[model samples]
Target: MSTTTTDIALAPGTWAIDPTHTEVGFVTRHLMVSKVRGSFREVSGTVEVAEDITKSVVDVTAQIASVDTGNADRDTHLKSGDFFDAEQFPTMTFRSTAFDGETLTGDLTIKDVTKSVTFDVDFGGVGQDPWGNTKAGFEATATVNRKDWGLTWNAAVEGGGVLVSDKISLTIDVQLAKQA
Candidate 1:
């Protein structure tokens, strides 16, 4: 559906992403039977809330080296040349091109490859914290083929399938604070 002006009803201004209160996470099938989850610990971004909410813009950056999957060894490997190659590509970014109230379409970049991806957004509404700070919450998810972004390192299992599935699922829970 096309995005309407009133789809996202928010005050017209700049809304900064509160990294401390946000989570950018992902899930991937492991060994064709299980799943592995991880998240980036450091992220920062902003949303330009235009008078017409549908025209708003979103840009976000995430530190690749800050990836955590609960396993130290796995985290290290993920940063190595086999996976993200964090040393060469230290960050991944997303810039929104459109929002249809429920879906966000954007360009996602990783390892120098850029691809258009869409996320289903779940609005959590706006609220004020104890400090009286106005905040808007949203939960978004998307799925993409990891190989499209050069994240194609895998090993074959003894029984069947590869060690990692090509598809990666992304989950983003963000809280934006209205900036004065």
Candidate 2:
């Protein structure tokens, strides 16, 4: 609805993520030629907006077992020890440490390893749904090295390069409803 930061400030309150309207996805190079995209089907999170938006906080968790890549076999492999090792890790989490208008810095944990990462965030504005719920939307993106999280399993291609690239791109589209 074109609500800019100057026009509509994020209401100061705790906002609960609407899982049905939010997406946590990623993209990575496959076989050094193409890209493979996937998403976690189950995610939960909350955003605490302060009177001063810079004081806000964000926390999120994505179930590793709920990974979907349009291919059941590939999903299974992603959840295995080669990747997330869902049996042991179960979930990946992110806790924001800072938010400065354009950038959001957070500690991301995967497979028990926590590292600080920054995401470029675009505030998509605030609005009210037909149901009368106050909602806020945001789109964020970041890139990280998969190997940094200890997800190093990869196969060499017959001709050249590797089956999987080390860089992974993360994209998040979130919609939060202000909690009562």
Candidate 3:
């Protein structure tokens, strides 16, 4: 389709991701003792690689209510005002502002709050499937203090750290399909 691009332009032509093959997930510490992880059940976005990504463009969006942590009670609390406030925020998003090699700076919006966040990205290279379809893969992740995102719900731990550590890690394993 002419809507997609063949040459690697500073802006990649429109590409619709296969959400079934792509994953949007995050990891956070539990009482500074172990880690807890989860993934959003819904996600969609486009990738516009104009010229090698550092100078390329990327825009991504994910539904806030789609958050799943394998626990029904916890997910509800996360949707409340104390955490994500999905009613007010609705969607959390990211749009790239700049990229320097594997390091990317972008605007991340969550719980009606927007901020610039830097994440380390790894280019896993593009390849062709057995069906001859072209695909590109990359991994991007970051660790942030939940307090900075205003998700400060926690309990005091008499032994040492709080009921939940302030630090939260976000990781995204992405697979993008190229122009057919």
Q: Give the alpha-carbon lDDT of every model.
A: 0.92, 0.92, 0.76
Give the runs in model 1 whose Cα sits over 4 Å from its true position. Answer: 1-7
What TM-score does each of the candidates earn? Answer: 0.96, 0.96, 0.86
Error of 3 at 171 (Å): 0.6
Q: Give the RMSD in angstroms, all C-alphas superposed, for model 1.
A: 2.0
Order of candidate numbers by lDDT, starting with the best: 2, 1, 3
State each candidate's clash count.
Answer: 0, 0, 6
lDDT per residue as tens, model 2, 8-121: 378899999999999999999999999999999999999998988888999999999999999999999999999999999999999999988788999999999999999988
The C-alpha stretches of model 3 lying farther than 4 A from their native spots are 1-12
Alpha carbon lDDT at 152, candidate 2: 100
Indicate whether candidate 1 or candidate 3 has the larger lDDT.
1
lDDT tens per residue, model 3, 1-180:
111123223225655566777778888877778887888878888777664545666788888899899999988888899888899888888888987765777988887677888888776666778998778777788887778778898887778787777877888788788764
- How does residue 44 of candidate 2 score in lDDT? 99
Q: Compared to the true structure, candidate 3 yields what TM-score?
A: 0.86
